[model samples]
Structure formats: C-alpha cells, structure tokens
Target: MWDIIKEIITYSLFLWIFLVLSYSNSNQGRILGCNGKSECPQRHRNSTINA
Candidate 1:
C-alpha cells in the first residue's frame, strides 16, 4: 500500500510539474535564443571597432 501511494504521488508530482512548465512556456518568447546549449549574441553597437 505504501509503495502504491508513493508511486501515485510521484506520478502526480511529475504531471503537475509538466503542466506548470508547459503553461509557463506558453506564448513565452525564446529563452536567450537557445535552450541552454549555446550563448546567444545580442545586437550591440560597437564602440571600439578598431581597438
């Protein structure tokens, strides 16, 4: 009984987390233009181009 309850709790937690994450990401803009794989460079005005 304990094992079953634990399993159900685990599954519920996972489902809830997934739903929350999906909802949060809905209509959300790109994250840094990358999914934690590489750094995205932003457009910047170069002040020291010849330096």
Candidate 2:
C-alpha cells in the first residue's frame, strides 16, 4: 500500500514537471515572435491582404 502511494506521487510529480516544461516552451515561441514583439501585427496585415 505504501509502495502504491509512493508510485502515484512520483508519477504525479513527473507529469507536473512535463506540463510545466511544455507550457514554458510554447509560451517562449509566442513571446519571441517576429522581431521580439509578443503581439505581432504583421499577421493581421497579411490576413487582411489575403482576404
């Protein structure tokens, strides 16, 4: 019973770490957008031009 509890805790910690890492990596991409602008306006311009 103790072993099962330990295993669950370990798995939960790993999952939490994985989720945090993934979120940080995704956020970095958005944060480092075109010329370091988080809210790039080029995307909107291109879309409007295409439309």
Candidate 3:
C-alpha cells in the first residue's frame, strides 16, 4: 500500500514540474537569433572591425 501511494505521489510531482517548466518557456521568445548572430546586445556590438 505504501509503495503504491509513493508511486502516485512521485508521478504527480513529476507532472507538476513538467507543467511549470512548459508554461515558463512558452513566453520566452527566440533564444538564438537567425544568421548565427548573438542575441545579447553587448556581445553583438563588441565585435572588432579591422580597417
């Protein structure tokens, strides 16, 4: 009986965590820019240009 209860509790906790992460990532827009450009503004502007 204890083992069955433990299994159910574990499954519920795993499902809850999965839902939370899925919800959080839904709002985050593209993490990487197209054309291999850095998404961060500072990194994008720091590239050195040679004359």
Give the clash count for each candidate.
0, 0, 0
User: Each prediction's TM-score against the native?
Assistant: 0.52, 0.54, 0.51
Best by TM-score: 2
Per-residue lDDT over 11-43 for candidate 2, one digit per residue giving the tens place of the 0 to 100 score: 999999999999877744356465434355544
The Cα local distance difference test for each model comes to 0.63, 0.68, 0.66
lDDT of 1 by residue, 1-51 (tens): 999999999999999999999988764235546432223244223433431
Write out the backbone clash pairs for model 1: none
Candidate 2 deviant stretches above 4 angstroms: 27-51
Q: For candidate 3, write residues 1-51 as lDDT tens digits.
A: 999999999999999999999988752234433333554443445766421
User: Tell me, what's the RMSD of every candidate?
Assistant: 8.1, 6.5, 6.3
- Error (Å) of candidate 2 at residue 47 is 17
Candidate 1 TM-score versus the reference: 0.52
Question: What lDDT, from 0 to 1, does candidate 3 have?
Answer: 0.66
Which whole-number lDDT from 0 to 100 does residue 49 have in model 2? Answer: 36
